[model samples]
Target: MQSRPMPQVAGVEHRYVVANGIRFHVAEAGAGEPLLLLHGFPQHWYAWRHLVPLLAAQHRLIMPDLRGFGWSDAPHRGYGTNARVDDLLALMDACGLDRVTLVAHEWAAWAGFMACLREPGRFRHHLALNIVHPWPDHRATIRHAWRMWYTALWEYPLVGGAVLRHWPGFTRYILRRGVTGVWQTPALEEFVESVRSRARAHAGQALHWQYVLRDIPRLATRRFRHQRLQVPTTLLFGEDDFAFAAQSLDVGGSHGVDVRVVPGGHYLPEERPDLVAATVSELFGTMESHREEIVG
Candidate 1:
């Protein structure tokens, strides 16, 4: 299963653009309202391969390699949530997309939340996969921190990069961890190899480092805890995911976030792209219909 050859999508066009001072590789398909899909750490645009064809029929899909993953430029810095959101905003500007519906997985989910929080009007709706909200109950997260032991390994500056660059098995193991079904596929292989690159290793580690060193402290402040979500959001969590418990997912329930328990593991984008695409399509349609109702 891991050895299967993964082919590129038939009608998708691959292009590169300068955004946030770095060259970003993007895969686009169809033509309608733009649906931007942001991938998580150790993955890029290719993670959305299955969803591209599924949703491309009704909406234009823009899937980029973020900044440091896939074929995108891996600069020395800019791995923070704010930085990544800025990159996405700049990419939208470069592509002339004034607004977009966002579907993000893992780390990129954080960026999506931040983007919507900072500029609510920029996004129509957000569908987040397997990630807790940016502002969560501190007590709940602290108790479940053990599940994130793997992230601690990534927080280190020296050994983290070494593990990614030298040990390909590490990436493969992490991607396969806790996921159901045959773990290895062509896309999974490509993702494993991408993180094996030294550049990606550095950038990936920096992502975790920023979360631990910067974001965690910010979470303690009144500003971060009081920051409310301004966009309609649906957070899907895998029932079998070990990294996050159900408690963390429900922290923002009071703020109108819909937390659903989907059957999968941490890697929902790859393991269950069909579910992801269908869910997003339904959400998009619902949001559009509500807008139409208001106008009427």
Candidate 2:
């Protein structure tokens, strides 16, 4: 059976804002309670393209191409988790938003979680999709450990950039592996074309590699123990996700986290936006009803 074409959400308005000395490209839609969606590595705001509209009916959706991806400035320094958290907050400030519902996938999931740690009250709730909790010390449990080889290589200064510059084909190869079951021909082509436009094919890959190597597990453990999130939160995962099944379950269980499983691979939102949207809508609706009951 052919998959349904991605839904036609209302067109998003694009804008650029200066955040922490870097310019960030933001795609915005709807106009209500703020909902910020953060994309992961090897992808840009386009990752959320299918999801924005479903939630937009009830939220003011804000999706940004985080620091080094898409139209955002790709500064060499400050790619760390703490730095990215700061960048996200700075963007919120630039947009005049004091509070929001934060949602993220992959590396941005770690970034979003850290941002909540820094200022819990600033986020009303969090929705993390397809990521292991951010703990720096914990070893990765991804099935194909070799797939992360690029992460270690990218940590080197001169060598990493040179490798990317010399061999652009590697980037596409790596991304293709990461994408796996999530993309059809048109979707895959769209992503490749977007990355190619950013710089040489390898520049985007280098930026993503930096994100993958960040010490996320340690940071998350500290935040989880020391600073519990009082905000209502949800964790969405794909049953077939090869990257951190045990870890994802543990984190969710430990925190009494609400968990939902959607049909897809690692790229939950992209592969099954309809399911993702329905799940998100249900979660937010439940939160709203509970709030109204308390207020009444």
Candidate 3:
């Protein structure tokens, strides 16, 4: 069954793989050291469409629609972070990849953290875009929690489904305003129209509800404090993002983890694909560092 309309990128291959007991839809392009690209909320593998061409020459890209998000099977289960992490690991096994560089955005970034901490050797490096790492300062998070008010609409069961299925403008508005810069013409249109589809919208609501139910409590209780990140990782956030305050994204004192704030809002993949691509290359150790970027 078609999950949703997917955009085509030249050199991209569409295939399905069973990972963690779910049939996942994946978009593949390029060929080199494996690199995994995981999309965040309200988007699928297509979120990285802009970056694919830029990074294709350097690394083989694996962009998967999280369990229910894109063309992947939307089972009524496995929306929790642990399940998501298992999916990542299982996907790697199915693809004959023991380790790969990771570029995870938004919601998926949160799970990326868990995957690294759970199996440090499973990933060589992680470039987390627009999401807080597990080791955040709780005081700052409490003070800045208001930034996530928009989630309340999507964190509940019935309400989130209705919003995505009925008032798709809410998702469209988020996508429109969340960008750090303007989305390239047709790309924004593709994302905007996608939320109107019930199958795709179902995953958005379910994932958000799972976040509030499981991930939020984990963050609140310092669920990852002792796990110390062993994999080299970078948490990159936008200066104007609404979901997380820069202060709230503070990471534990570890040389392996660094924070970079770039110019933009929440949607860095769409707005700053160049920067994302550069970061991916840097993490992969496949490109000499040449791009100039300001660390805010």
Leading candidate by lDDT: 1
- TM-score of every prediction relative to native: 0.93, 0.81, 0.91
lDDT of 1 by residue, 114-141 (tens): 8988888888889998887766677888
Candidate 3 weakest lDDT stretch, 10 residues: 287-296
| CA lDDT for candidate 2 | 0.68
Task: Name every residue pair that clashes in candidate 3.
Answer: 180-264, 180-265
- What's every prediction's RMSD, in angstroms? 3.1, 5.5, 4.6
Candidate 1 all-Cα RMSD: 3.1
Which runs of model 2 end up more than 4 angstroms from their true locations? 1-10, 135-159, 162-169, 178-182, 193-227
* Tens digit of per-residue lDDT, candidate 2, span 168-192: 4665565565533635665655555
- Order of candidates by TM-score, top first? 1, 3, 2
Which lDDT value does model 2 have at 223?
45
Best-performing candidate as measured by TM-score: 1
CA error at residue 190 for candidate 2, angstroms: 3.7
* Candidate 1 weakest lDDT stretch, 10 residues: 1-10
Model 3 — TM-score against the truth?
A: 0.91
Comparing 1 and 2 on TM-score, the stronger one: 1
